[model samples]
Target: MSYVTKEGLGKLRKELEQLEQIERPKITQQIAEARDKGDLSENAEYDAAKEAQGMLEMRIAKLKDIISNSKVIDQSQLDTSKVAILCSVKIKNKANGQELKYTLVPDTETDLKANKISVHTPIAKGLLGKEVGETAQITLPNGNQIDFEILEISLE
Candidate 1:
């Protein structure tokens, strides 16, 4: 049920491939190397390696499930009338006049460093479905309320 852009989906697929093809073999090699040390009952190296492998396998399975359930969103067909997933929005703080840009994305694709915010976040929630020139009252995690003016919305 994750709404992701085509580019986002491709990134997910690439990460999955890297984990399966490269990471899996690397972990397997580590296991084999640990096994060469013998002493199964009290071998700390072997135990750690096994634990690491289990964690890696779990991550791989989770990634596979996410990929299987994912749906890629077509940017060209998207409605740009208001803010929504995959839309890059520019907002200005009503109080301080500070402006910021953010791309609304699925939870999995959120990267603060990249200015991509999860749709579920307070700011994104306030911006969602808001058209240009509309003001969004956002409820921060700290329970503070702030108004943001929607300046622009584009596919970017």
Candidate 2:
């Protein structure tokens, strides 16, 4: 099962609608135009159009699967007592003494530029269920270890 916010679910729904209503028709028209130009065996345009259509259909199907299996969590009912999805956490690095803040979010809603990290990530997984003032040892992809102390957790 996939967990997502209401906003993320809405975004997926909008993308699916666009793929079905707008992009599908556009690709069909392109295919028709290409087919009218020449024979099927020698037509490069027709082959490219068909390939693009296949990729688009695959993307649409994946989006539909994600949406169908998703469970939207209510942000208002989220508790700030521990680290979880949609919870903003403040942590202090034990080795470097640097502080960092990140909002734990679903995979589909994760954006590094926005300081949103996926809950399935290593650091996020290590921080989950840890309360304030507790230290968590996280293993990085580079085989390095980092110790962090949870300073705060807020849903706002």
Candidate 3:
């Protein structure tokens, strides 16, 4: 049950198309060019090109698998009454008295720079299904306990 945004899914599809239609051809051309240089036994360029192709193919396969398993979630259908994927949550750290905001997102769409955290993360997992004004205690990777209060939840 991997969740993904419509935009994220579209991006993956576009990248897969480019890898198949553009990068694959470019790598094939490189291999052909390297092969024409002769001496396949000692052709570093050919080896490098082949390696690149393998990596590209692996990425394409992974992207295809993700796309096949992905479930696109509608933003409008998100429930604002509690924390959930695609929900923007405002929380206050009880230990430090600091307020932080984060958007719960799928692993593929999680970006720290965008303040989107993966749903599988400890903080996000603790926050999920918690309503406003409720306290959530989560264990950090360092084995420390952190308590946070849910301040708000919004689909916007």
Candidate whose TM-score is highest: 3
CA lDDT scores, all candidates in order:
0.91, 0.94, 0.95
Q: Ten consecutive residues with minimal summed lDDT in candidate 1?
A: 1-10
Clashes of each: 0, 0, 0
Model 1 TM-score relative to the real fold: 0.95
Model 1, residue 21: displacement in angstroms? 1.4
Report the candidate with higher TM-score, 1 versus 2.
Answer: 2
Candidate 3 positional error at 19, Å? 0.9
Per residue, candidate 1 scores C-alpha lDDT tens digits across 3-117 of 7777777888899899899998988998898889887888888898899889989998988888889888788888989998899999999999999999999988999999999
lDDT of 2 by residue, 1-156 (tens): 899999899999999999999999999999999999978999999999999999999999999999999999999888788888899999999999999999999999999998999998999998999899999899999989999999999984
Q: Candidate 2 regions off by >4 Å?
A: none
Candidate 3 — which pairs collide? Answer: none
**lDDT of model 3 at residue 38?**
100
Q: Is candidate 2 or candidate 3 better by TM-score?
A: 3
lDDT of 3 by residue, 7-42 (tens): 999989999999999999999999999999999999
In the predicted model 2, the residue pairs found to clash are none
Which regions of candidate 3 are displaced past 4 Å? none
Q: Estimate each model's TM-score.
A: 0.95, 0.96, 0.96
lDDT at 64, model 1? 83
